[model samples]
Target: MDERISCILSSLKKAKLTPKFRESEIIQLENIRSATMEDISSVHSTSYISSREQVMAEEAVLGHLEHDELIKDW
Candidate 1:
């Protein structure tokens, strides 16, 4: 995920879409707390998150299968 985010940032930089931030402005905080279920449920239902997870899992499996087919063709 970090690599993907870096790739996106690099692409944006190449396109001159993202403004360069100062080194001082880029703060990497440590030990950040994750949001609780109650906090998340305030905005989205647990069922909705579960459904989205299912969809993403299905898409990932389909993508893997497609990649495998392409490899076989090669």
Candidate 2:
């Protein structure tokens, strides 16, 4: 996922669409606490989260999951 984003960003740089996006590279938000169910609940309902998880899990094959939706249909 990171690689794909980086590739797109680099391509944008090559295209000169983003003048200093490469020079001003993105920095990861370090030392952030992992979100728990309670945190997620603040924004999403339990049923929706569960349904979303089931969909993602169902799509996982051989323990691998790709963000292919960005390029192809699910």
Candidate 3:
């Protein structure tokens, strides 16, 4: 198993032993509804979605640039 995955599993195991989990305070979603773009726009304005998309695109570009720089350094 990947070190990161093992660490995450270990963390989850530890979390289950906490008082919050023991008391069943956390709500876990059993069934998830698959939402369409129309469903999304119904909740959020078109302009808000557009701005969020732009910010996400900018972040993706920056992440790639940072990754490329790291590779170059190596």
Highest TM-score, which number?
2
Residues 1-74, candidate 2, lDDT per residue (tens digit)?
34555598567767865534434654547889989888999999889889877766765744544665442321
Q: What shift in Å separates residue 3 of candidate 1 from its native position after superposition?
A: 17
Candidate 1 has which clashing residue pairs, if any?
Answer: none
Better candidate by TM-score, 1 or 3: 3
Q: Once model 1 is optimally superposed onto the true structure by TM-score, how far is the C-alpha of residue 58 displaced, in angstroms?
A: 4.1
Rank ordering of all candidates by lDDT, starting from the highest? 2, 3, 1
lDDT of 1 by residue, 1-74 (tens): 22444486667667755434344555667999988878878999889878756765876866644433422322
Cα displacement (angstroms), candidate 2, residue 60, comes to 3.0
Q: Rate residue 66 of model 2 by lDDT.
A: 69
Cα lDDT of candidate 2 equals 0.63
Local distance difference test, candidate 3: 0.60
The total of clashing pairs for model 3 equals 0
* Backbone Cα, N, C clashes tallied per candidate: 0, 0, 0
